[model samples]
Target: MDILYYLQTFDHFIIYLVASLLLFGLGTFLFKWLTPYSERDLIRAGNVAVSLKLLGKMAGLVVVLQSAIRSSINLIDLAIWALIAIVIQVVLHLIIEHVFTRKTNLAKEVEKGNVAVGLFLGGISILVGLIVAATISY
Candidate 1:
């Protein structure tokens, strides 16, 4: 197979969807690492809306990354892949934290136990990656 062809496949699937999952983890760790305030403290401070807001912030960061990647790559097909990746990330995160985990608030779950949160994040990434691979176009 051509190397360019292989790269395209990787960009379409992994760069888009797989990267999104990674960005989620990256963003999560970033905020957790840098913030003086705990997720619970942020919740208690009530200066914000809710946990959904945290997800929103992560989504925004992913979007910014997607935009930067799209600009750098300058390929319509690749940009589409990035869009799919970001959507996969957000959708999967929401699904587990909301649909599967039975937790109304994801922050709470993470606060309860870090290990379980890490597992959930990784599990959702794979689930969403598989779904994106199955559904997205080349």
Candidate 2:
């Protein structure tokens, strides 16, 4: 293969990689804004529940981003789809939390280190991400 061709391929790879990272950062910021409590503070205080929940959200976002990158016709398309996926994940998570914790408070439980609730929330996030990713084709 020509060296110039390989260099061009690498440049494209770098551009996509950078774009994906920026999209992931935006998604993370959005998720934090939508949540009721401070995940960063809770995790800093050794709250496993918040940690798990955050991890799930990150993983879910990655799944959606991957799909967006694969299906997009251009960088702009990928960014748009990624943003839509982030909004969907965050909104659906809020709805699920409200529905499941009608008699309790998800934020409080998570603050108290309720691992089960965290795991459940995380699982729901991943599930939602998978569904959204699957629907992103063409």
Candidate 3:
């Protein structure tokens, strides 16, 4: 029973797992930067609406990650597709904010305990995630 052999066998799995986590963090960071208000702050203040919207964003990223993981042939391939997915989600957020939350401030709405806005954004995020996931292919 060689330790090196076991390590080698698990290297790919470990590498991919770490890479996925890093990608997830990057995706979330990008989202945080794009938004006007502080998600952490809002959530800390017990704002269910902010949490709901953030939940959708996270779920959307997971959907994208699932597609990338299933479709990627290698780590580099995964990275490329993951980045593309991130871009798509970011763009989707912008579109949602502009189209759905147009005439009002999304950040303020969420901070003010607007469950309707939160639910709407959450639904939109999941829908976009499904679309992105379905379209990904190896």
Candidate 4:
């Protein structure tokens, strides 16, 4: 009976793990699509700015997913929260790039290897993720 209970728990763990991974992949895809430049190409070319920016985005999404996994009532709820987190991160990034820094062309700067802007954007992304994660509690 104890073994049976453990097996059932393991099954749930697997389900959640797979679901979380899928959500993470989807979030990353959407983020890349929404960005102005190709993060993959930039990173491949040894652009530390793009690398740092992408890292922050990934880290932010992971933090949000962690909260969703902990607080969600079911798999569906987890999925919903994960989507919300992705949207929030992407939207906030756009807002910062377009609105907050109207004078500066962030995309161009990032492409030109502006580490300061990259670090600022990366820090903001992580900050937004932390805030969004904190709000995910039931």
Using TM-score as the measure, which candidate wins?
2
Which 10 consecutive residues of model 3 have the lowest summed lDDT? 99-108
Q: In candidate 2, how many Å is residue 134 off?
A: 0.5
lDDT accuracy of residue 50 in candidate 3: 85
Models 1 onward score TM values of 0.41, 0.93, 0.89, 0.91
Give lDDT tens digits, candidate 1, residues 97-120. 567556355455555444455455
Off by over 4 Å in 2: 1-4
- Where in model 3 is the C-alpha error above 4 Å? 1-8
Q: What C-alpha lDDT do the candidate models reach, one value each? A: 0.52, 0.89, 0.86, 0.86
Error of 4 at 62 (Å): 0.7
Clash count per candidate: 2, 0, 0, 0
Question: Using lDDT as the measure, which candidate wins?
Answer: 2
Clashes of 3: 0
Predicted candidate 1, C-alpha RMSD: 10.0
Give the alpha carbon lDDT tens digit for every residue of 1-138 in model 4.
Answer: 589889879988999999999998988888788888988998999999988888888888899899999998989999998888878878877787677567878878888899888877887888888988998867
lDDT of 3 by residue, 36-77 (tens): 888899889998898898888888988999899989999999
Give the higher-lDDT candidate: 2 or 3. Answer: 2
